[model samples]
Target chain A: MKLDSAGLQILSRHECVALLGSVPIGRIVFTDRALPAVQPVNFVLDAERLVIRTAVGSKLAAAAQDAIVAFEADEFDPGTRTGWSVTVVGSARAVREPEEIEYLAGLPLHAWAPGSRDHYIVVGTEHVTGRRLSSVDVG
Target chain B: MKLDSAGLQILSRHECVALLGSVPIGRIVFTDRALPAVQPVNFVLDAERLVIRTAVGSKLAAAAQDAIVAFEADEFDPGTRTGWSVTVVGSARAVREPEEIEYLAGLPLHAWAPGSRDHYIVVGTEHVTGRRLSSVDVG
Candidate 1:
């Protein structure tokens, strides 16, 4: 409901999660020694949990259990400088249940990073927000 | 040239910067309070400096002086599942110099966030790295 000066529409939580399903790739932001780090990963939404596959012992997998993380995805048309971006901040937990891991493996989650991507991490969408940039700014 | 098992090419510093130039939008990953936050912004790479515009009191603008940040941009085709992503990790500084602000204003840095976007911050690209997910894996 917050529209900035340019009339960029502040998307609702429902809208944010819906948009999350539209894109396959997004950046996952995490902290490394208190400094923010970002990496692009392909993800899938299983109901409300945002699932991603990372390599074993990878920086992402090694993230502290219940670590706070941020996920962002957007589809923009550079030609018109218009698009929608959604950000979800939540707690990340490793999927350790054998049954759950097997289920996630079949969820069509593709890890673009090459290697043994045997780790599954899920970020519960607690705070979802987004903005829509229109081609024509609302003056 | 560290190639991953999937044969994804590890991009060089020079190659990373070159790829960054090809995009007009990127995500500025910052820390809000004690947790990580990821927000998308329009930016322009000035040499090794990544410049972005934000509102005066926004979290991004109020980030700690010399705060470490990460900027990421990428393009992936769904059909081919191929794309490249570049990440620059460095310190962010507010662009306060009148002359500098004026010069940056003239650049094609579009601010999608509605507002005056008067505050400018520059991230010095201290460490630039990238990865290329090729449809053809070398493995």
Candidate 2:
């Protein structure tokens, strides 16, 4: 897929939503001690919000108290050197209502790691954007 | 890259370190308002430490003031349905010395987005691990 400047721009947005809808996993980015940190998380698209799961003592549970965060997901095709990335910038908050919890439970979000996996983390999108790079454009 | 139990275990560690070395950009996973949040960042590998750039009044600055964080990176091959992911769990700390800053400045990290990217966030790997998924395995 040869992406011209305009095509790259359009594909960035289209791919953003497409990747968001096709996958339930993303990277949660934030600052920890003046340094950048990222982690893989199982997420669900709740309306315009992205929701994830964590534990009580988990790092995610401690840092997201009234803070801004960045969430991202992407799909890359090495053969074609083509890929798209979508990033969501927003504040995170815990879901407390029983009804919402019940709704979230039905989603396919599961922790691939073993250990304590109990808490749920939700990132609300304040800014949503994406980008794409292709092999044809490289050479 | 079909993975048996043993292969999965070994691949996990390799994936984690490989991710740390492969990409210059990543997301920081933190907590805000009791929910999980993420942000994009430019980083460098300082030995086993993952260092990133940041600034004051940034969400990362607020999140890393004294909390645990999860850092991650990955490369996935959708055609073969195989990919590897690595995650680092650790505490975040600020880089205070001028010499350290100068050393970090010499690394190959660059920001993909335009913004105030001055502060440096460094997350040391207290624990590092990864996983690989493949459709075929020889052993």
Candidate 3:
């Protein structure tokens, strides 16, 4: 990994996906009513794609079907003011196949929101970008 | 202060603004080359608006001026599988006035990313919605 003068390291696609898998929660951003809306969801990855479980009637499920979306996850230390943030922008496709839904249900992913979370939204890993802040603001 | 049967509480605008003030880090989601992009920034609240200090040449500074954007912040507890998230969708107005810029620079807000952070992006609180999970997952 090459670190910039400011100690911000740019992460590759592989590294970004690996970090995504370790985190269970991330924010999914989509256009709702022509405005950007963000919601946090617990996700499990099928390779580099993000699989989110949500209620069929929820706004997230409604907006994610075959629409362009962005998923973001970050970890920061408030004490040190340093952390890594990864963002993935892709198409949110709805999983309609019964077999795939069953397979995803078997995964450890659980919806934190209280509701009948039966809808699955998949976002492909097409555009990925990430940056990690160093211990200090390096110049 | 409305609490649902599922233990999901609707936070009041005042409560939401208070929670935003308590956190120092959040994500700013904006359009980058017609695609949604998210970046983590340390923010300070100016009343109900989000103030982010960023580099002049950064994508955030470039895309934020007079643009529709979303700012999100949340806190979650993994052990309990519960958390609260607040998202704000509004227009980002660049702080261009020399006096206003100087005033904002004096505020405690500091840029975590390394660079000459000489720009300020402010997002108003016109659209604010937040949901908090109760102690138990009430169904």
DockQ winner = 3
Query: Highest TM-score, which number?
Result: 3
> Model 1, B1-139: lDDT tens per residue?
6785445789998899899988878888887887787778878888678988888887778763578888898988877778998888888898888999999888877675556787889998878888888753211
Per-prediction TM-score, please?
A: 0.92, 0.57, 0.94
Ranking by DockQ: 3, 1, 2
| Model 1 stretches astray by more than 4 angstroms | A1-6, A135-139, B4-7, B136-139
Per-residue lDDT of model 3, residues B51-109, tens digit only: 99887777788899899999999999878877888989999998999999999888888
lDDT of 3 by residue, A57-122 (tens): 777888988989999998898878788888989999999999999998888887777767788999
* Per-residue alpha-carbon lDDT of candidate 2 for residues A7-99, written as tens digits (9 for 90 to 100): 443355445666697875687776666655675666778776888877666667777755777888876654554566788888888767788
Q: CA lDDT of A111 in candidate 3?
A: 73
Comparison by TM-score, 1 against 2, better one? 1
Write down the worst ten-residue block by lDDT for model 1 chain B: B130-139
Misplaced by over 4 Å in model 2 are A1-19, A22-71, A75-139, B1-15, B136-139
Q: iRMSD (Å) of candidate 1?
A: 3.5
What's the TM-score of chain B for every model shown? 0.90, 0.81, 0.91
Give the better candidate number (1 or 3) by TM-score. Answer: 3
